[model samples]
Target: MNLTAESVAEALVVNVDEERIDAAVAIQFKDRMRDLTAGAGGRIILDLGRVIFVDSSGLGAIVSVMKFLAPAHRLELAGLTPNVGRVFHLTRMDSVFPIHADVAAALHGAGHDL
Candidate 1:
């Protein structure tokens, strides 16, 4: 899992550099995300611009992260490749979380004046 993190406006922008987010690496991804937002004080903008696929485990991991964030933090997804986006839509998971076109859009939607 090649991922990078940066602060974008009021959100933590996480760029996933992998082509697929599968069960093999979902746990690690989740852990890293949790660490990235540990002391951060805003929503998380996960930029899945490079991710071309996502399986049920990957989706479940994401949901778990969202659940973990709870009232303390928020999670937003952005730049979902067509295939990955389709999975979310197919499973109706897209409606379970907030999705954005890009980090900037996610930030703006989160009410950050960036």
Candidate 2:
């Protein structure tokens, strides 16, 4: 899981460089997210612009990342590909995490209008 994390305005934007997050990489993903977000403050925007697919484990991994940052900060999701977005919808995780249409919207504090 190659991720690029940057601080933009009031949020720390983490861009996932993979197209798929499956069982094989779920744990690694979670661990990496924790490291990337360590000590980072304010809102978190997980830019999933390149993510085309996500499995159950992948979903859980995302939730884990959120929990890891719980109370102190928030995790918001951005740039969901169609198929990847469906996984969140079907599993009802979209309501749990904030979803944005693009990275800009996430950075600008947009809603889940996508």
Candidate 3:
């Protein structure tokens, strides 16, 4: 799980730098999310452009990360490939999180600092 966290406007953009977010990396993903999200305020945009596949475990990990944010913050997903998009749709997670076509779109006008 190669995760990079950067501040973009009102969001903390965390890009998943690997090709897959399956069972093998699910734990790593969750743990890294915890470390990266420390004291992070406002919106979180998870850039999944490089991620091509996600198993059930991966989905659960993502959902858990969202839950950890809770009412004070929000988690948005961006740069979903076709297969990843389909999985989100099939799992009805598309309704749960705001999905953007790409990182640029996700950060558009979301102005903030730190």
Q: Which candidate comes out best when scored by lDDT?
A: 2
Scored by CA lDDT, what does every candidate get? 0.81, 0.90, 0.86
The TM-score values for the models, in the order shown, are: 0.89, 0.96, 0.92
Off by over 4 Å in 1: 109-114
Ranking by TM-score: 2, 3, 1
Pairs in steric clash, model 3: none
Task: Write candidate 1's Cα lDDT for 2-113 as tens digits.
Answer: 7788987766788898998899999998898788778878777788888988999998888888888877876778888888989888999888778888776776664322
Clashes of each: 0, 0, 0
**lDDT per residue as tens, model 2, 1-114:** 799899989889998999899998999899899999999988889999999989999999999989989989778898899999999999999999878898897776577867
Clashing pairs in model 2, backbone N/Cα/C closer than 3 A: none
Question: How big is the RMSD of model 2?
Answer: 0.9
Could you give me the TM-score of model 1 versus the true structure?
0.89
Which is better, 1 or 3, measured by TM-score?
Answer: 3
The ten-residue window of minimal lDDT in model 3 covers: 105-114
User: Candidate 2: which stretches are off by over 4 Å?
Assistant: none
As for lDDT, the candidate ahead, 1 or 2, is 2
